[model samples]
Target: MTTFDRREEGFENKFAHDEEMKFKAEARRNKLLGLWVAEKLGSSGEAASDYAKTVVATDVDGGEAGVIRKVIADLAAKDVAITEAQIRVRMDELMPQAIAQVNAGT
Candidate 1:
């Protein structure tokens, strides 16, 4: 292959890898967020883990927004009294930790 063609292929591979990492990071963040919310709702151990999994699954349907919506509704239903902004802030805070964890293969 020409040098230009090889360079293009390298760029494509990097893009694919970056996209995969981003997906992993987001999913991790969602799981962390779900666990935090679940704890607020008085869940623990297996119940919290299951709630986190549900949040990760919700991402398939609506990404972050959907997860946020689901958690907001859940919190409200349980009288937890949290705001969207607070959840969003928590999500932002978890993202870097999620990215680090994903990079570490944990």
Candidate 2:
């Protein structure tokens, strides 16, 4: 007689994947926010990295959407050329692979 092993994926695994996707979306948003802020601040190199961190860190206390809104608002307040339209366009271009990476946990 031959025996095979079988297993059932649990609800937790499904939920975990959902959370992972959410996180990945957030990371991509953070990256875009960083670039936006860097451009707005006329910062490059370490300063840009620092600004990105500051913006992303805000999400650590609040959440991903909050950080995104802050970055957009801050740039707008400073009269940067970045518009909500551009942000949405960039996000549309970036989201698919980001979602894949998130699902893969990379």
Candidate 3:
């Protein structure tokens, strides 16, 4: 392959890797968010873990908005008071941690 061809291939590979990392990071963030919310709702141990998994699944299927809606609804049902702005702030805070976790795994 020519130099240009190799460069293009490298760019494509990098793009794919970045996208994968972003997805993993988002999933991790969701899981972290879930655990935090679960604690607020008084769930512990295995129950908390299962709740986190559900949040991750929701995020995978419906993106950030889905995660937010699910968390908001669940918390509201349990009489836990939290605002979307707070959730969003927490999400932002966890993003870097999630990306770091994903990078470490890779």
- In candidate 1, which residue pairs clash? none
lDDT of each: 0.97, 0.71, 0.94
Q: For model 2, how does the per-residue alpha-carbon lDDT over 1-106 read when each residue is reduced to its tens digit?
A: 2232222345567789788778767776676567657877688888888887887678788775676687788787777767667766766776776676666766
User: Which TM-score value belongs to model 2?
Assistant: 0.62
Off by over 4 Å in 1: none
Return the TM-score for each candidate structure.
Answer: 0.99, 0.62, 0.96
RMSD over all Cα atoms, model 1: 0.5
Pairs that collide, model 2: none
**Ranked by lDDT, top first:** 1, 3, 2
Candidate with more favorable, higher TM-score: 2 or 3: 3
Name the better of 1 and 2 by lDDT: 1
lDDT of 3 by residue, 16-100 (tens): 9999888888989999999999999999999999999999999879888999999999999999999999999999999999898
